[model samples]
Target: MEETRPAPADLRGYCGNCFGLCCVALPFARSADFAFDKPAGTPCRNLLADHTCGIHTELRRRGFAGCTVYDCLGAGQKVSQVVFEGRDGGRRMHEVFPVVRQLHELLTYLTEALALPAARPVHAELREALDRTDALTRGTPEELTALDVGAHRQAVARLLFEASELTRAKVRGRKKRHRGADLMGARLKGADLRGADLRGAYLIAADLTGADLRSADLIGADLRDADLGGADLTGALFLTQPQVDAARGNAGTRLPGSVGRPVHWAAGG
Candidate 1:
């Protein structure tokens, strides 16, 4: 039996200072998951001028199931309040847009690092990084508004990669390095499997409803009944849209490869 990881407390709500960057910085495809396609750096069609989703109440009805599953790790508010210093929505969005997007990506990586079991032993280190990132978010308007964010994000990303490798080493049988392992009915729900090599792993009935599989190599992994209901698999490799549909998922699941969400979920048939 695989040990399960505990769910992390919701930390996004405490970050009200964001400008809703994720909705703007990220892109979406028109499919069962989203009502329309949005390009990176362009505001989502459903995004109001105020940076809020226009169809917030009807995301599922509108087919944007993917949009509903994303979390910004509080970086959205931090970038808006600290980096942009509460700039009006009408200001030079083009100038600061790239910075906000980069910061959001960095936050996504850091958040994944914090959830890995390998990082558990070094959680204090991860927490310290989080604190520093948080502090950067609260920096003076001048400091936050600058454009040297790439360097900062790269530095943190290196640490996260190291932590992920360390944690993945602890899982049993995973060390065999199979290109694809059979893992049916494994009960790995809510496991912290960041950066693990799951290339082509058979995960039928694995119950990975809310597992943190960020940056993990899942090339060709079978996902029947995997239950990714609330899981974040951003940057996870080799995942296909067909694999997602074959599995059980709800509105809260986030996936990779820009696959459209399943429409049957909305009809509840």
Candidate 2:
């Protein structure tokens, strides 16, 4: 039997081990998500010297909701410790960080796909892709910076698409195809979205209360401010914690075992 891969703890960020890469490397404007304008390579004012967010607990309250929802997919710690050996490489570290982040995201999807019983048909291929992607993440900074991430992403997406099809095929009846659809602020309350292809769809501020999103492919779908109260999202495909955090939900909302309910949900998010 193949060795059981460890749980996806490595796929999730452990900020305590990270070097404040996200706070310094990424750029954000003064949008509704962020409180101020920050340029690339510049550290956020709230990032402490110890590499922890000074306003972490009050990010949402301080108009920094974007920071609260940003998950590095474990790339921050990996780059800090594994890639740079815990030494802040400054510019080089910043450059390699985003590249590894993309790879980690693909790894996250592949690992999740392999765990699904419905995706057994593509298990071999998925395992191979996972191994290859993980290897890429371990490459040197120069190698990572020079890598063709878009091509790799396209290749991984094909496998994820196959895994999604197999899982959704288990759901009988007609399924919706809304890949990359613009559904912002739409009234979709009580919608039957089971097995729907919602990839890259703009769902901002949409009313999804009591909607059935089982087996729906939500990869890259924007859920910012989307109401998920009482929604059934058990078995939702490719759903990330960041997406859940960005959306508004309540205690009645059902979720997959892979993701936990956001704290704000308890307060009627």
Off by over 4 Å in 1: 1-20, 23-26, 39-45, 49-51, 89-128, 139-151, 174-195, 198-247, 250-269
TM-score, structure 1 vs. true = 0.52
lDDT of 1 by residue, 5-68 (tens): 2122323422345565666667778876677788877777666766677888787677876655
Per-prediction tally of clashes? 9, 0
How far is each candidate from the true structure, as Cα RMSD in Å? 9.4, 1.1
Q: Rate the local accuracy (lDDT) of all candidates.
A: 0.62, 0.92
Q: Deviation in angstroms for 268 in model 1?
A: 6.4
TM-score of each: 0.52, 0.97
